[model samples]
Target: MYQLSEVESNYRRLFKDFLRNSYISGLKPLLLHSPVQYAKALWLAFLAVIVVWTHIVVVNLTLEYIDQPTEIHMAPNLVHVSNSPFPAVSVCRSNMINRGLMNNYAFKIYQHQTQYEGTFANDSRYPPLDLERLTDRLMLLTNFFLNTDGKHLDIDELGQLHNLLTSYYNGSVYSVHDILRELTPDCGDLVVRGIIYGMPVNTSQLFLKRATSSGTCCIFNYRRPSYSQSPGQRELDDAEMAALPQVVFESNSILNGIQFVLQDTHQDDYTLSFLTNTAFRLQIFPQEDYATVQSNKHGEILVDHNTIVEVPIQPKFFDSSAAVRGVTPKVRRCYFPEEGRKLLNQSYYSLDECILLCRINSMLQHCGCASSPMAGTALNVSYCTLLDLPCLMKWRGIWNGFNEYPYVEQYEEGAEDASSMSQCPLCLPNCDGVNFEITSNVAPLRKAFNATGYAHGLLKSLNNDRPLSIIKLFFKLRFAQSTQMAMVGDWVVLLNRFGGILSLMYGFSIISYIEIFYYLTGKWFVLYYRECHKQKNDSNKTELDSSSLHWNE
Candidate 1:
């Protein structure tokens, strides 16, 4: 420490000597002796400040200028999936009554259930109604009344039984007889699937919950539908047909708000056939060092990857964040590649693939499984079970940029699930690379009933006594597809090296102002401090001499 302080002291002395010499030999001796020279020096200093100010303004303006020229051209027609950076499908549940019931049930169980009841419910997460399992004695008693009884129960008898069973439910019991008689099934042969491709928000799990009677048993039947495609074979009445659930994609909706509803029907044998096709086109720069450009005889330079492209200045929006937060710009601005980070990656993936990969990897990490809607026989990934849903939802909430507490408990680092979805190098998306424009047309599919077709044979073989119902829903989402070689990209080039260096005369550069500021202001304070110290010492000496003469007299 002592040596370091000594070195610093030596450097300070050297700097002081240099400053003193410059003032004494150069400007001070010349300017102080001559008022004309001093005025000239003052005038030059004032002018230098103005020049520096002008340079600062020029730099700010130049930063906003379009230095590079960009050529916009539509490449060959491409075919791809609809899951561009974001393809959201919002599904409104047609079954409002069932939805209300389920919402109430979920809330009641979650809110009022004891720890033991919660554990029991978790253990009895079975299909249809994920309720707590009854003990053997209770099960046997239910079986004796429901299935083992020799006599078929009348409506009155069933109502009485329901009352007995739900005595502890505080008058919230649903009548089995009334539900059976009143509930109308949806249209037969209407299979549906709504798959969200680009964003990580699970459209499957988001079911619309309408507020109804808080404690009524009517809320007991609602089950949140997962995004899925199922065969719809149950025949529906006129009201059910009109109220058929439909998947919607509104232009104003965001990715996280996407939703999907699965139809609920009674017939276990009913079958639904749903078909979906998606594609996307991406415009990007070719990664190769050299690209071929065609030009006409008119000296028109055909632009390609290496060609300089001029784009307007604008901030890029991610996840519709600016719009959601009400921070969107009034005037739209375009950003150039040179001005910001490289948004696109030099990889073999199409834009859709890159975005989908991001979604898939996120699901794997947070949800403990891949998206069931995206995963299939071709994709060797497990579907997220009902147990893993809360965990997935919490993770997605965090990723969606919502500044709220996580709904699920935190997972321990290096846990089995955490390690399962480790850093995926391949799942990264080019955040600012390219934007996508998409359009889709959905139509109901009609099929002629063929009794002698293969459908008859399959149904006959599966169950001859009961006729099978078939519901087929067809919709195709066609995205603009481009080959690996043919990409939807434009050329980006840097235009002015120094914002027209030659246009400004006298070889004046912005760097000169920066250098002047550093030299003048950076060390000027220290020099001032030393000068003030010298003046104080001279005054103290003069005071002491005056005091000594006065005392002698």
Candidate 2:
């Protein structure tokens, strides 16, 4: 009983010393007064509120740090440069196939079908084809190769068409890419003339062929490798990189920008008139990045015939700092180019490219082939023919829903079913890249031609009766806004925030926290050791006393 009492007294003394010396604001006042005093009770109540509020705030801060560790904000200053690299201009014909070539091919196919029917009069293998229906089916097949909108057939209809097409076309699968390339108007025929910075450029020699969702489009000032290039041959040489086009910041006039006179050769085809627009679709993007129909779909501008469209662009560059890059990709919500290359095994990485590749991978896994419009050939995957159209159409929902980098709300909503859904979480936004924001204004081509001081001589070489569309792309400002990713909730920042809250509530510093921890744990450990030693000495003395009694007896 005495030993137990002594232990209780020691514990009380230790606790009293802690309360008296504590740096906490209300603790000392509460310790000095009697428990019955109102002041002591008020101090206790006030300290409880402070502790609860501080705990709530600290917990919220911790949760915020865990959920969103970084933030994207506009830079303090605009980046002004003497020379900005010109953006790549991709021009796609709304009507992808040439009307005249399609008619000629359809006529030839109709003749072949007639001859086959006559030769195999009773043969069940060869189905008789109606000329008009054959033409419509041919157009539908070509539509699958291009990014034509709102012309989808049912799976059974597509399968039957594919079977008929395979049986009629020499018992072999027709290559859609080859046929589209053959029927589509050449870039030289479509892009009649090109000019940059008021100087005439060769439309044939300057433009390179790039396959987009809109079939094959001609690209200008694009420095990246074509999608058809093999993975091993995708890298650019030093000479090629050095020779990339660069333009000085000139006036925002239409004459100071890249200009193209586009001709719509397939405008007269009424069969596909409703399915497509009678205009040229333009996509303007960073010259260093690959341009795809999916990536640049939102930025596409359509110029109607006899209209001159002026597009003034402002470029914004986004970069991630070293502090942000030090965080994991999930926390930062972006990937450095090198990190993307390593993860995706691509020569370059962009959000669009990543999404495109993800879709292609999903298609390859499900259908055992990829559509020709996608970059599956680079991976040695076979292109899906007309026969695979049914399979491809069946999984269209899964393909369309395969989002790589979703927004915060989207991610949270889908977090529960993320494993089951077709999502690519690894494909985040590129940490360093450029984006162009464009504003377009359209004027009548005749009006621009009728006005005085238009001396480009575009009128001299072209007939006024033909439908011609003009597109101009230029920078409207010399300076660009930069957005940067910054570390907002790193360990150091979290610790500082937590310390500030504690200090505000309890007047506690790091030393005060350390002192409390020492008293709570370390001092208890020392007391426990001293108590064990005292008991042990008592036990030894008892043994010695018993031994002396035995010897005396």
Candidate 3:
């Protein structure tokens, strides 16, 4: 590849040099020379033309294999009709193609990113790509298709990438934007436009603000029709819990335009209606998203939808948060897909939110790992599945008989004026007078999970059992979780922590000691590359000099 480029550069350089010198160097004598000489020169020129054509053909073919869009196995195009049941219809989607190519082609973003680095292939250790991975798209053709390769690709370059795609989708076809949002009980309508590799993603867009006038009655719209609770249409056993709705509403914030959708196994057929009737609108499409999502937790391409709504409020470019012209980001899982002319409402998950949930669960997990919750001490652990850890485990006692480990319980604080422990379903009597009352605010959350039947009521009963400091800390956490205000503050703090960790990781990666070893070993490879370039240039120069000398003779 390098040789071919170098040769092309050398040939172009020689041509330019000859043109510049000819006008000033008395080249009029050549045309006046004998016809025999001109005939021989024409024959030589014809051979050179053939050689250049061969070189161009070879280089083009090589790049085709290295970097290009694979032909897309296009799905039948969906068209909207005026008579459809769901009204206020606006249709938009994107596809890429070319003249000669018979079918629609898409760029396999995974394969593309992996191709640059030798990361993926049919290797023994890794599993195969499942159905979830296939439909999830990473490469989005944006209004301004940003090329991360640090090179500008006009029409010519895109053609080389894939002749098929280039022929079609040559310019902007759909004025659409994407946004990514999380698949929550409340999240329904959203879309994703930007790319997150190795993860199944979907998107939606909606306005976000602190809920309500007194900051209490926050409005939300899950971008879908409200789920009218009827047994015939679908079953609402666990997910559509009426008892624990307060927990879902606790951290309430107003998102202007999101429609709710439910996803199991990364499949979206269900959605919650957070729109018109803000209160009891827990919707579901098919509940297929859970099964689909859980099936490939290692990673999967989540196939979800992004709602495209042309808002009349304001429009702006996507550079920074300030430049973003919308309600201050609600900081949910979803993201906005595009930033150009045709605005898009996208749906996606926010990494920060996931990390927050992970951090919260991390504490629970660590706590679980620490104590033997068997005889009078630890709770019994249940293995739900491969990915799921048990709720609690029991403490193994000194005697042969294993004592009863209480369910996971909360402990009230010992500090002065500590908030009262809120009660949950699992009310185990404390042997040490360790009273753990569940707070009223979070009590609804506990109820919601229970309504779903999977909740093993907060196995809390730790009241006054341990140290004062630990008790204070646990109470403080409960307080923060109870009050939505503190929860938001915690999220911001987590963001800062995450940013710091990322900076440290990046700072160390380039200068790490192992890199030093590779630097030493690979320095020779770079040196050899330079030498090769130098030799090729010299050879081209020598050939040009020889041709000049022969012409003079």
Scored by CA lDDT, what does every candidate get? 0.30, 0.68, 0.24
TM-score for model 1? 0.28
* Of candidates 3 and 2, the better by TM-score: 2
Query: Higher TM-score: candidate 1 or 2?
Result: 2
Candidate 1 local distance difference test against the native: 0.30
Query: 413-488 in candidate 2: lDDT tens per residue?
Result: 4343342123666677788877778889999877335434245576445764457888877778768788888776
* Candidate 3 lDDT over residue span 69-118, tens digit each: 12112123322211111111111111111111111122342343344333
Candidate 2 residue spans exceeding 4 A from truth: 1-13, 34-39, 59-83, 111-126, 143-173, 209-211, 224-253, 273-279, 288-290, 293-298, 322-325, 401-422, 444-457, 460-466, 481-490, 525-553
In model 1, where is the ten-residue run with the lowest total lDDT?
A: 289-298
Q: Which numbered prediction scores highest in TM-score against the true structure?
A: 2
- Give RMSD to native, each candidate: 20.5, 5.8, 32.7
- Best by the lDDT measure: 2
Candidate 2 local lDDT, residue 58? 85
Q: Compared to the true structure, candidate 3 yields what TM-score?
A: 0.16
What shift in Å separates residue 36 of candidate 2 from its native position after superposition?
Answer: 8.1
lDDT of 3 at 302: 16
Error of 3 at 368 (Å): 23
Q: All candidates' TM-scores?
A: 0.28, 0.77, 0.16
